[model samples]
Target: MTVQDIRAFNRFYTNVIGALDHRRHLHAPYTLTEARVLYELAHSPRTDAADLRGELSLDSGYLSRILTRFEQDGLVERAPSAQDPRRRRITLTAQGRETAALLAERSDQAVGSLLSAVPAADRARLAEAMRTIREILSAGRPPRGEDIVLREPVAGDLGWIVQRNAALYAAEFGWNTDYEGLVARIVADFAEDHDPHLERVWIAELDGRPVGCVMCVRDEAPATARLRLLLVEPDARGLGAGDRLIGAVVDFARGVGYRDLVLWTNDVLAAARRLYQRHGFVLTAEKPHRSFGKHLTGQDWRLNLTDAQQ
Candidate 1:
């Protein structure tokens, strides 16, 4: 697209979204930037003025003025950071949280109204176009490692795990639908039989999308746990996601009093094997198997957590 075309589209989007309206407010008269700042403070665990300025790309002077207004309005509270006395940590007051919630609700309603105006069949296309635009624009940007998060899986995530694993394995390793069926069954069993205290699954997310997953399940032996379905998306590789997932599983297994952790994988998955080895898992056995439409060498790896700690 040419510069003019992009500029024209930007102008149209700004108008459609009322971005130029400085007086727009969800529950009170506040600028869009103020609403955004409140939203950030409410959601973030801890943040400082410098961090906010960097994240929002705001001028230091402008951000200072906005924060001053917020403080004067009794919408925020600041305290000296424990790590650095000079830096002040910012947090939202009860009033500020209420305002932030209102803003979020109204923002959702606004977007919902806009989408409702579009034809039903075109809505999905529009959403995909937005994702395409974001991906293209962010192609060369350096990833922030801190933005990667490991969270408990919620509704629809199990299905996503199965679909992504199936698609990625098929494309990368020529795996067949049989492997997908196997993943489906594993996920189904986990959903139905998992115990919250002993078994857990974590979904790794980057930019609010599922990029990786790992699960710890009670193994056949009562004191052993099995790590299963470890996967990292192609784009998310080399970003330490695999290491983090494995670390999470190891920590969880140890915390729950598991003496040993084990996993099964095909010999062809060199990257995964390396990850396992790096995390103190030893290759214990291998067997030839004809499965998933291929002759594969099934390998078993084990980690003795008790011995490793000593």
Candidate 2:
């Protein structure tokens, strides 16, 4: 798209979203920037003026004035950080939290009303287009390893896992739909009959979007666990997602008293194999197979948890 196209879209979106309207922000006394600051403080674990300035890209003097106004209005409290008394930490007071919550609810309602105007069939397309725009823009500056979070799967995560794995593998490795079918079956079985005590799935997210996944499941052999469906998106590589997912599985296996953890992967998956080896997994077996419309060597790698515990 041309610069004019982007600028026109931005202008249209700003008007549609009331981005220039300070008075429309929940009919509150605070401005839009103030509401954003309150929201960030409410959601963040650590908050400081420098970090806020960097995040919002605000002029330091302007941000200081806003913070001063917030403090005067009893919407914010600042204190010396316990970890570093030299630095001041900002937090929302009870009144501030209430105000922030109100702003959030109003904002959500406004967006909901806007979206409600669109046909239901087109909402998904709209959302996907927004995601595509974000992904394309963010391709230049990916998140760091520290920003990645590995969490348990929630509703709809299984379907995402299957879709992402299928699309990524097919595009990158020329794998066929059979690979996607395999992922679908594994996910379906896990969702249907997984044992809570011994089986677990982890989804790695960066900036709230899933970029990788892995699962630990009960193996057929006694006291053994199997690692399955370990995958990291191409855009998310080099951020240590694969290593983190493997580590989560290994730690879960050891915590649950499993004797060994095993995983089957193809030799062509060199990056995954490297991560497995670094995590103390030893190659045990390999064989050539024609699957996923390709001739590939399926290999099994095992890690002994008995030694890991010591």
Candidate 3:
């Protein structure tokens, strides 16, 4: 549909639904948005939230708050996705399923009531019109903003970092619990005790949810800081999230008066290497080692703070 066509349809549909207001007509507890979520859960076999947000085109933070409320009310349970542990799976409880059924039945009745007034032949036309709209517009995800945000970790953000790091690496690189344990230690150390001024984490928020994260923490070497746990979700890549995260880490390291910023990564992470080089980090040394259930070349990259004028 053209822009004008969509606008016209939206206006007409709003008026139609406004008269048949679901809240009043359905006489149910769930809001429209809540009903929409329940409907998705009831219908779709896929359970992970990363795809859910994409399918629904809802704001990540807003969806998160909704899910949190659902959890509190025992309407939904969230766990790691079996297909990809990096993504979270959302499931409805028995009570939740009952509620979903009620919502579904009411929704069907509401639509049925609306359709009762129209001729049977026109109902076929209406169904076809809806299909045409979906066929045209449903293939795309929402357009992303040019702006990506970097902010401090929130209540669940730290644990998210560990889970993502562990699960993502294992899925992407065949790493094992050994790597997970390492990440657990790093996250534990960061959370248990740290100098807030000298050590910091940046959660890269895109579309109102975290898509990437990086951390700057005090290194064993004097006056040096380590850049650690740099990761961006696969779907969120190529949108400059990695660059932004690296930039944030560099800025934080420099701001804290660290003379040098350093990081270690495997040679296999060519894209990450490119980002590091783009940010003026130089490869100082590399060594091959067997770790994470694989033999890999570990590369140390460093940036001298004085030369980093930008």
* 10 residues in a row with least lDDT, candidate 2: 19-28
Model 3 segments beyond 4 Å from truth?
Answer: 1-141, 145-147
**lDDT tens digits, residue span 76-152, model 3:** 88888655778887877767767776775666667778889999989778777775665557465543534355666
Candidate 1 — worst ten consecutive residues by lDDT sum? 19-28
Off by over 4 Å in 2: 1-142
Whole-model alpha-carbon lDDT for candidate 3: 0.79
What tens-digit string does per-residue lDDT give for candidate 1 at 93-116? 656656766776777666766677
Using TM-score as the measure, name the better of candidate 1 and candidate 2.
1
In terms of TM-score, the best-performing candidate is: 1
TM-score per prediction, in order, is 0.59, 0.57, 0.55
Q: What CA RMSD would you report for each candidate?
A: 8.7, 10.0, 16.6
Task: Name the best candidate (by lDDT).
Answer: 2
Against the reference, the lDDT scores of all candidates come to 0.80, 0.82, 0.79
Q: What is the lDDT of residue 118 in candidate 3?
A: 94
Q: What is the lDDT of residue 215 in candidate 2?
A: 91
